[model samples]
Target: MQKSRLLMKFQSSGHTTAVLRAMSYASPSSKLKDMTSGIEFYDKITYIEEHFEEEKDVLVQKL
Candidate 1:
């Protein structure tokens, strides 16, 4: 019933392509939608990367 077990079953049955296709069309659950606000996953990654870059530049300038 777990996600990994389900995925393994699909893979063992050679239904990986079908599983991928279904997942590609699947939408986020309402719970997930309701929980999300402000920056998204990739946006958060970029925000952190940019912050680190700024800090690195400041450190380099001080050295």
Candidate 2:
């Protein structure tokens, strides 16, 4: 779940796509498949925004 938030933030900020590529190489245990499922994107974002309330600077730094 945490990793998914990181990936989404990376994507939202227009990183060089390296993040997505790296995710592809991640082990199945990372739950990359669940993260990549399109249906979960918005929900995950909402969850992150509501729960983590992550600051933009922190998010960018994590990416």
List the RMSD of every prediction in angstroms.
Answer: 11.7, 10.5
Name the top TM-score candidate: 2
What is each predicted model's overall lDDT from 0 to 1? 0.45, 0.56
**Tens-digit lDDT track of model 2 for 1-63:** 655665676577644344444554565633465355432445566666776755666777888
Q: What TM-score, to 2 decimals, does candidate 1 have?
A: 0.25
> Could you estimate the TM-score for every candidate?
0.25, 0.31
> Residues 1-63, candidate 1, lDDT per residue (tens digit)?
233454454467655434443444465653243223212323443454568766777657766
Screening candidate 2 with a backbone cut-off below 3 angstroms (N, C-alpha, C), the clashing residue pairs are none
Look at candidate 1 and tell me the lDDT of residue 33: 34
